[model samples]
Target: MGVLSGVKIIEMVGLGPGPFCGMLLADLGADVIAVERPAADAGNPRPWELCSRGKRSMVLDVKKPGAVETFLELIDGADALIEGMRPGVMERLGLGPEVCLARRPSLVYGRMTGWGQYGPLSQVAGHDANYVAVSGALWLATQSGQQPDAPPGLLGDVAGGALYLAIGLLAGILRARQDGQGQVVDAAMVDGSAHLLNFAISFLPDHYGGSFEKARPAALGMHWDRPYLCADGEWIVIQAVEPKFYAELIRRLGLDQDERFVNEQRNPAAWATLGDELSVLFKTKSRAEWTRLLEGTDTCFAPVLAPEEAAAHPHNIARDIYKTIDGVLQTAPAPRFSVTPSAELVSVPPRGAHTKDVLAELQINSKRTGDRGQATAVGSPG
Candidate 1:
């Protein structure tokens, strides 16, 4: 059993972050039940959609007369509920936090959105790029004068939104277990993305003596810290921040005799020129040759491998960072525990695959609750 083996979560299935949060919980051993739309396209959730793994799926069309009540019944026994919708969408569906919390006093309600529930942009539509743009995260990704470019949707959706919502849900669950009072966790991509930028924001002023407006290209933009193309058109990145490591890197590259690199660590003006020189020098060797020379050294170097290439790398293979499940490649569950490591991932369920079993379990639970005079109403099939 995993650490969270007994925790139960009800996920109101939506796109992007909502499913991702459920996936995280499920991976950690929460019994996460995903309530998918009954009429959702069957061709959509392919096996490669890793977010749907380790979840029990059941279709419930809330627009049906009795479906809302059925959903609430599921909420009544759950420790937490995750929903990703606009500000008032849940309220319209009669499954809002207020109603769910009233029915289950200890329920941890996790709300995920691009802009929070009450912000000026709360009801406005947006995706990962737009949310990161508003949070000032997208701006930090650019060079001194280059246009900003985000790494697809990974930063804002998975890192900022889903991870924060999962953390908030877990924290709220702990508090509710102690005090028997539930609360809503408002997880907004805009807020979480801004929180993620705290490191860089503080580092700019405190460490670099620079502000965002007068942002000078620092370590991230410098030559030794970034990726350089190799002879075979592959790339490798090196970060030798400390003096010793930088000196070791220069020695390894036979650049100690170059006067242009001497004392260049202390000279910001020489960074660009040294970077260009290093760029030219790196292209003389293949990425594999550089990896052989620098990978295990204190110079802090790594080849820039693509997704498929990353899975095959010796280090990643040894660590089992990636697993192939039913012909689908996916990352393994992370932040492992010594006492109760997570189990191998189960197959993604088909929509409504567990409907009969879940409903039977709910019926048994309701009957037991009725014996104790605390029964909740369960809806009939629509």
Candidate 2:
């Protein structure tokens, strides 16, 4: 049993963050039942997909006559419920928050959407990048000359959308456990993405003129605190932006006596030239060579690694940051506890693979036993 063992969460399946939140809960030991549509395809079954690991799945064709009853039955004892749909879609299916809450009064109702339940753009069809774009997040990432590149949409979908919704759902569960009451968690992808821009937004003047033309306080800007390419073509990130750490970085680079680089209080003018020089200097050494020289220093340097590289890194391997289950590698449960740490990965089920078993546990059996589950999911991926 894991830390969230026995906790029940029903995820009304959708793309991106919805699956991700369900995966997080399942990883932490919740009985996450992904209520997928029978017609929905559950993407690839690769364990490295990261967000799709650690979930049990069921397929219910809600358009069928008795599917709504089945949904109500599944939610009777659920502790939390999450759905990512436009405003009225769930209501049309008779599985909206109000109906589910009426069935299970203590259910933590979580709604994930691009805009929100009610907003000017609530019904607009958009994805992660579009959601983050209107929130001023994409603007902050633009370089001095280049166009603002898409940030791969991770912030709004996974980090902002999924992670925040997971946290909120867990928090709501704790509160419901204490107060014998439940509440709604309005987790909007745009809202979460906007909240992530707190640092940048704070620097902006509310009135006017303090637009994107402004730099990021020099101390926090990407000019001096970004990735530089190494001789091996891999990137090493350096972020010693504080004065003391800057001094340390200068000393490590053997530039302590350079008059222009020494004046920490007024060095913004030289940032352009210094950044160019450091770029050339960094490219002179491979990532491995620099690791030996800067490992324990205050330079705040680290080599950027790809997913496969990260899984096999010495530090990650030493920390047991990832685990293998059924020959497929995946990240371990996180935010660890000393006394009640979470369980490691057991196995990742294929889509709709647990339909019969879960339905049997729910006492909704159609009396067929052996191989019935596999038979039902014959065309589904596992």
Candidate 3:
């Protein structure tokens, strides 16, 4: 049994982070019921939607006759409900928070959006890039007077949306359990993305006497934490920042005799030159050689690991960070527990594959259904 063993949640289906959130919840042993539109609306199935993994599915034509009642019936028994629709869409469909709360007072309602529920851009169509771009995140990437580089959508969608939503869901679950009451959790990507830059923002105040652009040369910036190439075309991250760590790095690199590289304060002016010198020195050694020299040391150094390499890492493999499900590789449940560990992946069902099972669990009759076959994908389940 997982920590969230008996918890039940109703997830209104949407793209991207919404489904990812539901997947995380379901992975933690919550009975996530993914409500999908009927075949009439989207007859062509989305089989390999990874978000639908670890969840049971129910198909309801919200536009049809009794679908609203069907949805409420599920919500009536659920402890939490997540939706990613626009602000007024759920209300228009007669499945708003107010109505759901009236039915189930202790139901934690989670709303996921790009701009949020009440902002001016609430109704606007946007994705991960748009959200983070406006939140000063995209603007902060350029170190020099160069064009801004897209940091990919992971920062906004996965980190900001999926991870934040999961945290909110868990926190909401805790509160609802302890107080016997539920509240709305608003997880906006823009808000989360902006909050992601909180640490960097702390150094940008006027009292700090310098802007973020000017502070790039500081020791705490990404310039110091970036990856460096090794002799074998592999990259390694060296965090020789603090005095002690820098001293250890110097010892590992056998550069103690270099007087200029020995002084931290004086090294700032020659950072570019020193960086080039260190890069050249690193290129003379392979990643394995550097690892052997600095592995257990306090140098704060690590090699850049590919996904496959990460899965087989000593620490990760010891902790069982990845698991195989139906012959496919995927991540295991995170945030381990001393007791009541999260359930391992038994099997993943296809999209709409669990319609009958879900409706049956809700004590609804599926016998009278027409020739509505189960929906499944080839590679993976969402």
Candidate 4:
């Protein structure tokens, strides 16, 4: 049992953010029914594709006659509906917000997209990198003279798209429960990515002591705010931005007595020189040696561990941050609750694995139905 134990969500299975949003809701104990397309190939499904955990899968071909009616019947009893199609795709399929909300007035309709439903580029095809590039987040991630290297799908797709859609759906569900009315949550990746960059955009102008032209370098490329290489070719990140932390870092490196560094700690013109000097010094020790010296100190230091290393780290092990399911290692459900904890992981379902079971549960008899002779239930229950 979880906090959202009784909540029901109908998920229109698509790619990327939509599935992720459904995964999050299912993780929190929502009874999510994923409506997968009939005859669509999913290739070889992997257990480590942890997004599909804790959900039931059903096959429904919306293009088939009466299939939309069957889908709408599921929507009629749902608290929310999640979809990630292009602007008018759902409308064309007869499962748009207007149709679903008319059937179930309190349904939280969540629409996830790169450019939203009504933007100038709403129907344009794009992925995570394109969305982040347009959002100015990718630009902000670049160093002084380096090309902007946005992370692969984490920033824009998962963070901006899936997380924001989940939040919007939750908020809409709350509002609907109170007012008996629901509205569409148009979660645009471009909009959410821009929103995520708010802190950096607001912080740079007023707080950074350098020209706007050199802002990226001054802020991120500073000696005390970046990663350095170790003798073993591993990396460690140091972010001693505050005076006390910086002083501690200098002391640990035995550079506190250097007159040039002591005098130029606050000077923007000296950052590159200081960074070069620090780089040379950092390369003298292996990552483990530095970790032994400064891992738990206030120098604001952390080793840049790879994914495998992170899973085995002591802190992660203590917190149980990762779980191995069926020999597949993956992260645990996050933001735990004290009262109603998230349910344990279940096996990811094969396509249409629960079709007969779900239809039976929904009380729709497929024996005497429409064109395809499959289950079809139309309209809201009286």
> Going through the candidates in order, what is the number of backbone clashes in each?
0, 1, 4, 0
TM-score of each: 0.91, 0.86, 0.87, 0.91
Runs of candidate 2 with Cα error greater than 4 angstroms are 39-50, 202-223, 324-329, 367-382
TM-score of 2: 0.86
Candidate 1 local distance difference test against the native = 0.80
Best by lDDT: 4
**Model 4 Cα lDDT, one tens digit per residue, 196-314:** 87777667666664344455643545788889999999999998888899999899989899976776777778888999999999899999999999999999999999878999989
Cα lDDT of model 2 by residue, 1-382, tens digit: 5789889998877766878888888878888888664433333443224555677777766655566677788888889988887877887778888888888889999988878888888877888888878987666656555666666758788777888899899999999999978888988888888888776756678512366556423333434587888999988888776778878888888888987677742355667777888889999999999888887788787878887788988899998987777776677887776776776676666667778777777787533322332221111110
Which 10-residue span in candidate 1 carries the lowest summed lDDT?
A: 373-382
lDDT of 3 by residue, 1-382 (tens): 5778888989888767888889888877888988775555545666336667778876666654555666788888788898887777888778888998888888899988888889788888888888888987766755556666655667787787878888897888788889878888889888887888887777677423466665542333332445689999999888666778787777768877888667742344667677777789889899988888887789889988887788888888998997777776788877788887887777777557787777776676654333342321111011
Worst 10-residue lDDT window, candidate 2: 373-382
- Cα lDDT computed for each candidate against the true fold: 0.80, 0.74, 0.74, 0.80
How high is the lDDT of residue 237 in model 2? 88
Error of 3 at 277 (Å): 0.2
